[model samples]
Target chain A: MMVRMAATRDGYGDALLELGGNQRVVVLEADLGKSTKSLHFRKQFPQRTISCGIGEQNMFLVGAGLAASGYIPFASTFAIFTERGFEQMRNGIARPNLAVHVCGSHGGTHTGTDGSSAQSIEDLAIYRTLPNVTVLHPCDDVSTKILTKQLVHLNSPSYTRTARNKSPVLYDGREDEIEIGKGVIHRDGNDAAIIACGILVSEALQAAQELSLEGIEVTVIDMHTIKPLDEALVLDVAKKCGKIVTAEDHSIIGGLGGAVSEYLIENYPVPMKRIGVADRFGESGESEEMLNLLGLSAPFIAEAVRKLLNS
Target chain B: MSSIAELEEVARKCRVRIVDMVYNAQAGHPGGSLSEIDILVALYGTTLRVDPKNPSWEDRDRFILSKGHASPGMYAILAEHGFIQEHDLTSYRVLGGKCQGHVDAKWCPGVDFSAGSLGMGLSFGMGSALAARLDGSQRQAYVMLGDGEIQEGSVWEAAMAAVHHELGNLNVILDCNGIQNDDFCDEQMRMFDIPKKWEAFGWNVKIIDGHNMSEILEGLEFLKNSNQKPNILIARTVKGKGVSYMENNPSFHGAAPNDEQYALAMKELGVA
Candidate 1:
C-alpha cells in the first residue's frame, strides 16, 4: 500500500489557521514565522498574530502575558531556538500554569542540512523536566492536527515538537485514539515490542513488519506524549513482550529511549535496546541520509530487535 | 480618586506594612520595597481600575510587578486595597501563605502575572495590552520595572516589541531607585541618561520623583492621555525612602531589618 507523506509542521499550520477563528486564540512567532509555518496563521489573522522579530525570549513572556489576560497564545519558532527562551517559558508560562501552546518546528535530525545547531535533539528532555508542562511529539500530520486542536482547551502549558521532513501518515482521522499520555499500540506481538515517538514511529512499524518476515513478531507502540508518560501501557508491554526496543529521532540519552528505560528499570527490568543518536551531534545532510546515519531508520531498528532477540 | 494628602496617608500605611512584613518574614527585600511603596499605593489607590471583589475582572486594568523581589511592597498595597486580607501580611514568605518570596499570581489574588526574575514584566504587560486590543477592550496595562532590571537583554527586546506593535495602552514605570541587590546600579552597570534610552525605543518618556504622590499621579494621568505611543515614566527614587539608615544602603536590599533598625525604621515612618 502506498502511504501518503506530509510534514507535521504543515498540520500545525493548518490547525493554527482553524484555531484562528476563535477570538481568544492569538499566535506569536519569532522571525522564523515563514520557516516554522506560523505565517499561515499570520496571513489569515494579521491583527492577532504578533511578529516578535528574532526575539524568542520576549515572545514567550508576551505569550504568558496574553495567557494571563485570558488569551490562548501559540508561540512558535525553530525547535533549537526555543532553548533561548527556556527560562521565560519556565518562569512566565509554566510557573503560572498559564494556557500557552509552545510549538517548536524542525525538531531533531529530521530538520536536515541545518546541522546540530538548528536541530533540537534534547528539546523534549529540557521541556519534560519543567513542572506543569505537557511535552508532546507527534509522529504524523494527522496526530499533529488533533493535538494542536486539543491544546486550545487545555488550561496548562504545553510544548509540541514538529518535524521539517515529511513523515508517513500513521493514523486515520480518529482524534479519540490520540489522547495525550496514552500510547497507541499499532501492532501487538508476544515476542518483543518497539516503543517510539516522532518520526521514528513509522520506522518502528516498518521494522516490526520486517521482523515478522523472519518469524520474529514485535509490537509497535506510538508513544506520542513524552511527559505524563503512559506508564501503565509501558509496564504491560514489558511484561508481555519480555524484550523491548526504543527508537527516536533525538539523542538516546534523554529522549523517548531514556524515558522508557528509566521507567522499566525501576519497575520491569527486561532486556532492552535504544536506537537513536548516541552521545553525538548531527551534521548537515539530507533528512533521509541523516536518519540512516544516526541509526533512526527501519533497518537500524530491525537490527536492534534482532540483536535483542539473540542476546 | 483620592486627594494627594489621602494618597500620602495610604502610602504611609503601605510603607508601615512593607517594613512589618519584611521584618516578620525574616527574609525579604526591604530597601527596594520601601522605595516602590509610594508608587504602588498611588496606582492601587488612584490610577488602576481594580475591584478587590473581582480580581480577575475582564476589561480591568492590569498591573505586573517586574521587580518581583520587592513583592513586600506589592503585597502591602494589595492588602491595603482589600484585595487580600490584612492579616495575611504577617504570613509573608512563610509556608502556606499567599504572599510568597516573589510575586506569584497563582498564590496571590489580584496579581495579574507572577514575576521574580527581572526583565519579564514589560513583555508580559505588552502582551496583555495586545490581548486587550485583540478583544477590542480598552483595558490598560501598567508594568513597574526596576532600574537595575533594564540591564537584561530581554527587557530591550520587549521594549523594541512594544514600540513595533505601537502599544499605546501599555505603560511602564521604571522605579529608578539607583540601587540593585548588590550595590548602586551606576557602580555596577553605568546606565547614563535612562530617559533618553526609552525615547530611543520610541516611547513617550517622562522623568519624575517616584516618592512624590502628586508626581506619580501626574505621570499616570499623562500616560493615560498619551495614546499615540507607548509611555514610560523614569521615576527617580531613593533605595530606602522612609528609613534614614537604610537609605541608599545596599546591605538592606535583601536583608530584613534587625531589632534596633526595625524600631528606628518604624519611628522614622511614624508608625511606632
Candidate 2:
C-alpha cells in the first residue's frame, strides 16, 4: 500500500485532530507548535491543547500529571529539546508506566539548515535504550497517522519521531493492516535487503528502482518501530538475503543499522553496509542538499548496496 | 480540619513510618523525608481537599513530591489516608514491591505522578493546574520542592511557565531545610532568597516555619482564596525535625536509620 506524496508531520497533525476529538485525549506542546504541526490541534481544540512555552522538561512532567488525572496526553516538541528532557521521560512517564505519548518533530537531518544541534539524529537510540518505551519513525503520512493512533492507544509510554521536510509516501492511508512490531517489506528480492525507516523508506524504494536496472533485486523494509524491533523479520531477511544494508537519517552508530546489526551479530553473522550520518553532526543546508552531503540520499544508499553485494 | 494537636500527632506517626520503613529495608531517605513529614501531614490531614479512597477524584487537591527520593513520607501519609494498607509499607524498596524508592503513579494508588529526579514535581503541578482550568474543574495543585532540587534549570523554566500562565490554583511548598544529596544546599548551590526568586517569577510568595502547623494551614487557606496567581510557601525546616540526632544533619539525606537510631527517633515521636 503506497501513496504519492506527504509530510509525516502532516499525518501527525491530522491524527492529533482525530485524537483531540475524543474527550479523553489532551495535547501538550513546548512552544514548537508550528514545528511539530501540533498547531493544528491547538487551533481546532483550544481547550484540550496547551502550549507550555519552550519548556520541554516541564511539558513531559505535566503530561504525566494530565495522564494520571485520566487524560491521554500527546506531548510534542523538537527532537533536540525532547532529548534534553529524557530524564523526565524516563522517571515520570516510562518508570511510572504512564500512558503519555512523547512525540518529537524535526527528526534527523531532515530538519534542515539548523544543523547538528536541531537535528534529532540520535532520538531513536536514546528512546530505544529506555525500558518499556516503544520508539517509532514512520515512513510517510499514512504510516505516521497509523503509528500516532496506535501510540495514543498503547498502555505504555511511546515515542514517535516526525521529519520536518516532505517526503514521498510509501504506504496508502487505507492500510488498516499496520502492526506495531511488524516491518513491511516494500520490495521483495533475493540479492540483498535495504532496511530503512522514517523518510529513508522512500529513498530506499527509489534506490531499489535504480538498482533493479542493473539486474539486482534489493529487498526494502520499513522498520518503523525501533524497540520491540521486528527481530524475527530482520533475522529472516538476514538469513535469506545474506547481505543487508541499513539506511536512515540518524547517526549510523545507533539507529536502524545498530539495531539490525545487534540482532544479526548475536543470532546470525552477515555482511552489512550502513548508510547514514557517518559519526558526524549535520551541516546547515537545504534538506535535499543535507541528505546528499551527509550521504543519506537514494543514490548513496544504492551505492552502499552495490558495495555490500560485491563484498 | 485537623487541629494543631491532631496535625502534630499525624506528623509524629509520619516520622515513625519514615524511620521504621527505612530501618526495616535498610534503605530510605530518612533526612529529607523527616523534614518534609510535618508539611505533608498538614496537607493531607488538614489542608488538601482530597479523598484517599478515590485517588483520582477530579476535584481533589493534588500534592506532588518534587524531591521524589523522599517517598517514605508520602507513602506514610497515603497509608494513613487509607490509600494503602499500613502493613504493606514494610515492602519498601524490596524486590517486586509496589512501594518503590520513588513514587510511581502507575503502580501506586495515591501517587499522582511518578517522581524521583528533582525539580520536576513543580512542573507537574503547573500542568495539573492548567488542566483544571481547561477542564473547568475547581482543584488546586500543591508541590513540595527540596531546596537542593531548585538548582536544576528546569525548575526555573517551570516557574516562568507557571506564573506566565497565571495558574492561581497552583501552590508550591519548598522544604527549605538547606540540605541536598551530599552536602548543605548553601554549600552545594546557594539559593539564599528562595521567596524573592519566586516573587520575581510572578508567584505570591510566603515564608513560614514549615513545622508550625498554624503557618502551614494559613498558607493553604491563602492559596485557596487567591484569585489568579500562583503561590509559593517557603517552609523553613530542619533536615530531621523531631529527632534530636538527625536534626539538621545533611548526612541523613538518603540514609536509613539503624535499629538504635530508629528506636531513639520513635521514642522522641512517642510512637512506641
Highest DockQ scorer = 1
Which 10-residue span in candidate 1 chain A carries the lowest summed lDDT?
Answer: A172-181
TM-score of each: 0.98, 0.94
lDDT of 2 by residue, B44-142 (tens): 886778777788787788888888889999999999899989987987898777788888776688887678788889888887887788778888898
For B1-272, candidate 1 gives per-residue lDDT tens digits of: 78999989888888888989998878899999988888888888878988999998888999999999999999989988898999998879999899989989889998887999999999999999998888888889999999999999999999999999989999999999999988999899999989998999899999889998889988888888756589998899999889898899999899988899889989988973
The TM-score obtained for chain B by all candidates, in the order given, is 0.98, 0.96
Off by over 4 Å in 2: A1-4, B56-59
For model 2, what is the C-alpha lDDT against the true structure?
0.86
Residue pairs in candidate 1 whose N, alpha carbon or C atoms collide under 3 angstroms: none
Clashing pairs in 2: none
